[model samples]
Target: MSNSSPTAARLSTLDRGLPVWIGLAMILGLGIGRLMPGLGDVLESFTIGGISVPIAAGLLLMMYPVLAKVRYDRLDTVTRDRKLLIASLALNWLVGPAFMFALAWLFLPDHPEFRTGLIIIGLARCIAMVVIWNDLALGDREATAVLVALNSLFQVVAFAGLGWFYLDLLPTWLGLSATGLDVSPAAIALNVLVFLGVPLAAGYLTRRVGERRRGRDWYENRFLPRIGPFALYGLLFTVVILTALQGEAITSQPLDVARIAIPLLAYFSLMWAGSFVLGHALGLNYPRTTALAFTAAGNNFELAIAVSIATFGVSSGQALAGVVGPLIEVPVLVGLVYVSLWARRFFTDSSTATSVAVPVTSKDSS
Candidate 1:
């Protein structure tokens, strides 16, 4: 489990063996997907509020643990530290997504599917993953919580405009689009609401109720630890289903994965480098700088996958591009956490020294 024991689990996931877990998640997903491709669609999902979305039944089932430990009320603390909030938001949304948009087009001109994947994945920023990553990075708890809340709210408002403007039409501007595409704001919203909204609400509700019936400690100590692994395992399972959903496509165009990944890799490096330089110029702390850098750099592959599936069919090269992203992102982000730690040395600040690796749990998730 890579030092994943509950009582003393690293606040972030960088304790020792997270790369192995991320690798396992990817391998297990691909393996199961390869063995039972049809199994991915075995579960029939239902629509809520007139939306046809993947029930994310497995992912929903996984949320109980991830949400159990997060104390939602602590969200107020995020407002107290405005400096970190401003830095993280600026870097994550503006700089990061822009870099991804440019690179996705530049590196993937011939491949529309992969380009859409890069665009969708890039436009979407952190809501859930950052909570875990921030914890993993030992970032400022209040500040990170605030950013999560802020980013989610921001995406809700900005998703349609930026996603469509940047991903589809923007490509046309660059003389890159072979076909004129219509971006469905409804589909994007549906994906966000179902994949992200439901899991988060379920997590929060379960925690709130458990805290009432037994005790916060019982919920935190007993229930959450058990459920935490489920969320991750479910996440891996969903990835498998997602991969299998695109199995034939990925197999058909093996090089497409690398092609899509190139821009993602470049965007990731640029965002990280940009944030670190920005933080240094602005004289932020290590923890804060890492938070800024990673918040911009890492992606929300789950929602990205949902959007790809809805917008471009599950097996479309675009969706395949989205799937390939996390395969690169997980290990790379974990590796970056360590690299950020090393990079912290260059910052010459005490707080930067603290925010180096990814934490396993998000104690402040609201």
Candidate 2:
């Protein structure tokens, strides 16, 4: 299901111009919202029977790229970096969320709106931005692929549980379900597969065909190169429309965003620092260090958004908070990528091997 090395490189280009594309998506979303409000509303809805399928389009639309790069073969190779993977899980699901909860509880309490937003951002892990951040951090794709897949699979359960539990901490105005662990596991699981699995299968299949037909070179040279940028634009446009839709809400509460930004900045710095210390202590080489540090720092927002919309209403502040998570995540992780690269010189190969070398492909990761 995964692409060859060339295909990986080809697919990666979409992520480079992320900021620009995100800006364009904002503009496009605005235009769409204004020119075709009715259609826009429809596009926003994910109806089933009597139910409103909120953010359905956003969830389904953004998965194109996530699915495109999915590699079925990744499971076999995941073992090469077991320590790094375990560290990522510990940090992302456990330590990172814990920090986010504590930070939200600390900073944004006076402003309920921003406090709620921070909680949503904290609980939701990631989808899109992590891959880009991983690359920027000089992480191995094999490692990223394994972690990404596992993260996606976990979001269904984590989203509702974390959202309900944490939002319950807020004042009663939020109306988050504090009652119990009430969301059905099966339903959430189905939605995850629909959003994640379908695209994953499609990406796997596409890679399968491309690899067989013209060979890996053709895939890298042709199709992947073409789709990569378009997909980035697609994801960007999705965010823009989302922002345009929420433009009024966001602008009105500039201070709220300002308030939330601090803990988010703090969260990034803390996670990065933790990873860097751990990477060196563990004796990871440059590539492994990059992978280790990034795995701790990045998130999976898309899955969180989907779960948020499912739990919180479409227009609910909780859902909006979830959307805002990537605003902080993308650029910060990109910065960390270069930071990891610079830190590479500090470690000797012997240190990397003796320190970081647990088991593996035996060479420095690119």
Best-fitting candidate, scored by lDDT: 1
Range of the 10 consecutive residues with the lowest summed lDDT in candidate 2: 354-363
TM-score of 1: 0.77
Tens-digit lDDT track for model 2 on 118-199?
6666655554455545544445545655666676667666767776666664434464323222356565566556655666
For 181-238, candidate 1 gives per-residue lDDT tens digits of 3556666566556656776677678868998999976876666655555556655555
lDDT of 1: 0.63
Which residue runs of candidate 2 sit more than 4 Å off their true CA positions? 1-43, 46-75, 136-138, 163-182, 306-312, 340-366
TM-score of each: 0.77, 0.73
Q: How does each model score on lDDT? A: 0.63, 0.57
